[model samples]
Target: MTRGYIEGLLSSFPKLMIEGQQHTTVETDAVRYVYQPLFEDMYAVLITTKNSNIVQDMDTLQLVANAIPEICQFGSQDDIVENALQLLSVFDEIVSLGHRENIDMAKLKAIIAMDSHEEKIQDIIEKNKEKEAKLELKRKAKMFEMQRKNAAKAGITGAFPSTGGIGSMGDAFGSKNSSNFAEPEQSTYNNEYSPKPTTSAPATRGMQLGRKTKGAEMLTSLNDQVVHVSTDEHISVVVNRDGGLENMEIKGDLSLIISEDDKNATSIRIACLQDDSIQYKTHPNIDKNQFNESGILTLKNQTRTFPLNQPVGVLKWRFVGQSEDSIPLSINCWPSATGDGSCEVNIEYELNSVHMTLQNVIISIPVESGAQPVVGDIDGSYDFNRSTNTLDWQISVIDRNHKTGSMDFVINTENLNSFFPVSVGFDSSTSYCQVQVLEAISENQSVEFSSSSKITPDQYYVI
Candidate 1:
């Protein structure tokens, strides 16, 4: 057996090895010893039966000699002890059941270094999830801090009520969660406050104005004041840095809440500027044909009345704009690096809407961490938040009186891209499609109803 031959060769290995010899093959009465010097004093020896082929044993010994240096950093006794298990695995790979395996250095190394593509992808996904969770936590904390400050400013000493959920806080404050950027630190424009109607009409009945429900409890408390007509419009715009529209989307929804006494209200007539680019969809329960021909929202069955004391969505419209002119506001950002490790950023905004006035416009520009921006010239107020590392430029209102604004600031950063992909949030008093509710008709009589329209930015950014 090979075990007996190995034991005999180990006993006589000291006498057989020479000091400066590179390799040797010695034969005893029963076994043969084939070994080559590894380093100064280490030797990789192979013991075989006397009848075994010396040429093949020498070739195998050469392989063992080459692999030792690849496995161990230094061919010292300490390295050999530390990598004993790995060396054993390599030896087993080279010779299985006393028969040599046909493997080269490239294949051997590849086998040792096991890599999986799926594992790498999973790791990347886990990292992204972790990043999103952290961002959400930061947003919640910022919202709570802003709420606390606003409460203090309003002279409220009582403890704040528990927010129903994380999302409820943003909804209560008239802010939507942005996917690509952090939430604004300050309170956004009050979306609940409806603008005064431009034209005068007869006094409306059973209508409550400037009243917004905070949460589920608030809604339950103000049940009597829930009868109203409201329109919500969300605009999302994405633009490239140079000049082009990446994407532009406009969505509008009409909601109605009627009191029990006004259940007889047959149809709600709406007037809107006709546009071929707009697509309209009515609720399944409403008459789609009538809405397509004339903007009248009514049920299919004449006998059945509208739902009482419950909110119902009647009409929805969507518009996808391919041209840049469709954007209500256009923002241009220019960042240039100075000779010093700093950058000068100039941002300009222009109102493209002919009649609509934008309010509470906040443009958030990213900056380097722990870097302060020196504002040279700004049309409106500006604030640099160190915690979030962003410089926010705020304009109260942008109408015909003030349709353009600019901001210039300098920060200690050489990266021009750091100041890019600006996030914008604003409120508009008019809808993009100019859709307006004219009157509610019941039994061929004009019904007194109140209507309000509001526009909010869903996702507006420049990259």
Candidate 2:
């Protein structure tokens, strides 16, 4: 009968503990079963002795609850203990109120076992909380170690755990320390020879180091090679490759240091009035139309020819392909010339700023005239000189209107590369200008004076 009663209660409370309300009176003939031998015998003794001390009996019941396996199916011994204690607590109140007919000793003991059942539950909760706390501490410790390693990699010295508290975990990763990681300081990596900034550009290092993009320098060099409005003919310069030539051609990058004063000057110009050849690539034998397919194929030969330098202006060359497209492949010829070693007839004159008058100052004369002078249209000059010379000289003016007698000459080691020396003096009485000429004489070449100043004192004579 006791086993039957226990089974019936177990069926109602599928879970170990039954948290519910039951009303009305009930009676049963109970049969007991012993899954735990000692606790089951203690419980049966309490039931047989109708006047058992309920608190002492409830304590024994709780011991039974604790002995039950944690993974036991729902409504096992522990749950039974909890629910029985609760029901007995209510039954004691009922018996005290004189409604004791439904009271049973086993049920009363089960109800009083609530304290022990709850104590066991509290122990389990506490254990899980302790484990979680330990895991959290481990996580925090690993994060701190990572931060220290990162700081060391960044070369920061004396870094220790912060008493002020940790910063953001995200910052401790690769982000905040990235800039300092394995990087030299700006002051250190920079060129030590770089000139300090001043009003003028730095003579040694004109541009800042590390400021140029990866491919910018190469692009800029190619851009500079593009021709834009050639004003004068090409000039001669040293044609040596910096690192010797190979494969009948030069490779590797080279730069020509041009003076700021001559940056605007034309790269090419006529060397003399005598007909000199504009160099070109020519092959006497090989023509493009009849390639190697023709029998007895003769390779082309190259020669230089003189072309008339009529257009007194500059021309630029933009490189395309250097070879013929079809099978008769021949390499293109490039001009290996520079203006660095060339010379120019740089003319300088001092004029009276106040007078604003025109004076025909003789710039050059006949040195011997095997080579005639070539002149472009005289670009107007600022500030004119008031001349006092009474002696007039004949000036050779080219008639550009007829398009004849016009001459252009380039300055070189062989030609008028040497500048004509000019001397200027003032006459106080007439406010006239007096001029003397300086001549360039080679050991073999002879020079002569052909023109003189045209300005006299009549114009600027103040009454």
Candidate 3:
């Protein structure tokens, strides 16, 4: 259709146009045009052949128009101009080879999110370089410690032997010279030992560490790494994962705690394996919440339970926010090769930002049916089990607001699968339920609270 043809029809419907009456179609001899006014001075016009089915054609046109907002988020010429390249791709996907094809919303989003693998690979390179520098420093420290230990072995009467299975395992676990968790009043600035903020949280722009965020639900600590609090009752929480908290026996006085009468517990997760719940035993007087569809134990409209003795609850149930939430503790593994035929695996793992402290933090890595990994530099103690083709790492304790540990292993590529998630386990105590209302609200009560969570494949990735 000619511009004059549409202009003539548009002139007659100028009143309707000004009133924003969308979905107006003007038919002409050669083609039909459906117009949707976008902004003050611009519009989207979808022209179709006269032979095309009007309803189907118009619906497809609407779908294409709807997806524009998903891309630009607002209706402005600036939005269109800024996303020119991406919109151009969207147009192609909506109409393949100048013919309308699939109009799948999810597919379009996935396409946009998957931006420039080369850029991501470059980022990984930059991060790995920083990690390698830290590894070198660790090597120098190890050498210094070994020398000090040798000297002490001669002069000191009861010093640990140098030939023990762990050359300096005691030094790694609990040493005054080493960096440990900071007290609430204590702080560190711009040092390797400083506790970094949550690296696994959702990525954001212009987020500086320890700065107060505008309109945040809760003000995070510029220093403390123990717990994160929000507006929901000043609730400070940490789920412990000490000593892997496995196959434990609890013989304490049983008391189930409750919170505000206006609120209820939405999640109850034990970080042990999901299958281990079969071993759980609770009292008949307990008013326990059952698991939701997503596996969180959803509790509502309940008060404190009567006290009993001897209670046991094994870790079970998938987390309610499993897809969105990150692991409080995690592992990162990268497989690479040396110039020679030998291959190496670089691994870094640490505690995430949360309220609880994890004691006896450990990691388990599986090897192929028959392969030995040679790893030195004792940041933590390691034990190999030939029967299971696995290596177990034991760190005595990982306290709140602490730095991470890294190490390298030379392994045979044939001894491993393409990739597998490293499993981590720990034990921890509870953050009690003690909240107070300002007004003539209910009085606060303190009850012991213990919880934990584990993520398998924490964040999924390929080798």
Candidate 4:
């Protein structure tokens, strides 16, 4: 009945219309007809019972007219089909279950947008907070810079040799720390270095360390070659016959400076990992109890004997494979900032299965001419401005197993070409893992090996 009445009224809408009228109503067959002009040739006809409000409904019709143009590019049926889903959503916001719900343009558009205003507001707030943190860090750095200039004028040498003031030092670095980022007392440094906050990312805003994900550069360098080697005393592994780990022996015997007791001494843990195969078998004595479910060998205290000063400490295990990689240490790098006449770099690394403490770890980064880099974020003991165009970083000792380290600093170079090779020269203390399987075991497997590492330049391109 309603549909029949609507069609009859719409058929005679042209005859009952008032001139120069945007909205009007007429009674036909004793049923009131309500409608308003949407376009020059199109109109929206609202069918209703006799009790429906007339004047108040014109307001609703006006809102519908206003909203249609914003949603439909052209006032035609084709435009409605092109944006059918959007049009339905907009229409639903104005009317629900064939009845009017809301007609206020502000609320209607907001509902149709489906955009979370709260989230957008939170993002703005976070950006402002990060900005303020960066500004505060700059302010402290400037204060230290001024003091260093004054000290230089007084002919002071080696005053505050390192950035000793306002330093972040603790086990909870990058884990937990003071958030307020309180100001520290003034101090002079021979260099322009500021101490990192003892807690979190307050100091390294706009610059971050660590890999969120691996890229082509990291993948290309992981195979066939990894760490750079400068000295002897590297670990060598031999795969026994029948595809079992036959022996793992340290080639060089050297004095180990152990800082902890016998119970807490560093011990190398070896896991057999292959690329093509997952179910590689191990020797019976291979510690399945400490074995990792991820198919990697677990080097534990009870499984095998890793003794100090025993240059040829052997472990009998083998698997059928031409290659095995136990990457002891891996570095991840990405460009953090492209500054005015500068480009900042952030570095992160993982020390995998490394059992012993690193006595002296020096990271060498090649720098170009007129490009000076200042290292920070991990007691950045560095010597730059070398004639060889290299930046030498002396980092602190890494003690904990599965340890990780990070640093953020900048090099003064334009955006054209900046990132260069970043390699570490740690005291190849005691032993480092080098895996290669041999079907026929022999003395020829014994070889002194070294690695040459580089960070590809594409990883640092900010654009």
lDDT of predicted model 2:
0.26
What tens digits encode model 1's per-residue C-alpha lDDT throughout 335-401? 9989898889999999887678888888988665556799999999998754345688999999877
Predicted candidate 4, C-alpha RMSD? 32.7
Q: After superposition, how far is residue 18 of candidate 4 from its true place, in Å?
A: 83
For TM-score, candidate 3 versus 4, the one ahead is 3
Which ranges in model 2 have alpha carbons more than 4 Å from their true place? 1-115, 157-463
Better by lDDT, candidate 4 or 2: 4
Model 4, 1-463: lDDT tens digits are 4889567766776788776442356766666666644544566656555776643354455456557777875667787679888877876777676577734554565556543322332333244345545665667567766777788889986663445554542222221224535322222211112222123221212433673322223223222221112113333233321233333333221111111123112322333334342233333333455444533232333433222111112233222223322434455556555657676777665665466456566655555445567776755477762333456667667656437777777877654323433444454343333232211111223222222212111011011
The 10-residue segment with the lowest total lDDT in model 1: 186-195
Selected candidate, larger TM-score, 1 vs 3: 1
Q: lDDT of each model, Cα atoms only? A: 0.69, 0.26, 0.43, 0.44
lDDT of 1 at 314: 79
Q: Which scores better on lDDT, 3 or 4? A: 4
Question: What's the CA error at residue 127 for candidate 2, in Å?
Answer: 2.4
Whichever of 1 and 3 has more lDDT, that candidate is 1
TM-score of each: 0.52, 0.15, 0.29, 0.27
What ranges in model 3 sit over 4 Å off? 1-319, 322-325, 414-419, 431-463
Best by lDDT: 1
